[model samples]
Target: MARTTIGDEPRHADYSPCEHAVTPSGQPRDPQSACPGRTTRPVVCNQHGDTTEAHHF
Candidate 1:
C-alpha cells in the first residue's frame, strides 16, 4: 500500500487521521487497521530513535 506523511499529503489525498499515528512508521492505521472516522493529536515521539513532531495523517 502507498504510504503518506502527515505534513506531506497530496493535494487531494484520500487520507485520514489515525489514532495510532503517534509514531513515524508505515501507513497510518489503527490497531484494527483503520483511519478516518478517528481522531489524532500532536505528540512528542522518538519511535524512530529521533525526536520528531509526530501526529496523525
Candidate 2:
C-alpha cells in the first residue's frame, strides 16, 4: 500500500486558528514574534546581524 501524507488526509476536524502579525512597513512579522500577548518583535539588522527586541504600548 502507498504511504499517506498528512496533506493527503481528509479534513474532518476544525484546527485551531491564529492571527498573523504585520510590521509597520506592512510586511509579515517574523516567526519568532508569534508569542501570544507580545507587543514587540525583535528585529535583526542584516548588515550587523544584531538583534534587538522592541516593546509596543
Candidate 3:
C-alpha cells in the first residue's frame, strides 16, 4: 500500500463524542451525581479500548 504523506495524516479534529448513552464502564457519559465511595470506572478510548483492571478483586 502507498504510504500517506506526513501532511496527509488523518484528522481526529472532526471526530465527535460517541453517541453512547453511557460509558463502557456503565457510568453516565455526563455524570450528574457522585457515587457513595470510590469509583472503579474503566477508561475507554477509540484507539486503545477500555482498561483491563482498576482495583484488585
Candidate 4:
C-alpha cells in the first residue's frame, strides 16, 4: 500500500484483499460479525493474525 495525501485529510493506505479472506483497510475484517459489505461471505481478517469466532464459519 502506498501512502498518499488526499486533500486535507490523510488517507491511510491499504493493501489488497487477502486471497483466503477479505482485507478491508489493509486489515482483516473481524470474523465474529458479517462483513460490513453486507454479504455472508466467509471472509477473515489476517492482519495481526487476529481470529474470528469459532462458529463464524
Indicate the TM-score of model 3: 0.21
The TM-score that candidate 2 achieves is 0.19
Worst 10-residue stretch by lDDT in candidate 4? Answer: 4-13
- Compose the digit string of candidate 2's lDDT tens values, residues 1-57: 543222111111232222455555434467576423324333434333323444222
For each candidate, the alpha-carbon lDDT, in order, equals 0.35, 0.36, 0.37, 0.33
Q: List the residue pairs that clash in candidate 4.
A: 28-45
Give RMSD to native, each candidate: 13.5, 17.9, 14.1, 16.0
lDDT of 3 by residue, 1-57 (tens): 543222112112233233335554545555664422223333544343443445222
Please give, for residues 1-57, the per-residue lDDT of candidate 1 as tens digits: 454323322111233434345234344445565543323233323332212444443
Q: Rank the candidates by TM-score, best first.
A: 3, 2, 1, 4
**Pairs in steric clash, model 2:** none
The candidate scoring highest on TM-score is: 3
Residue 50 lDDT in model 3?
42
RMSD of 2: 17.9
Total clashes for model 3: 0
- Give the per-residue Cα lDDT of candidate 3 at 55: 29
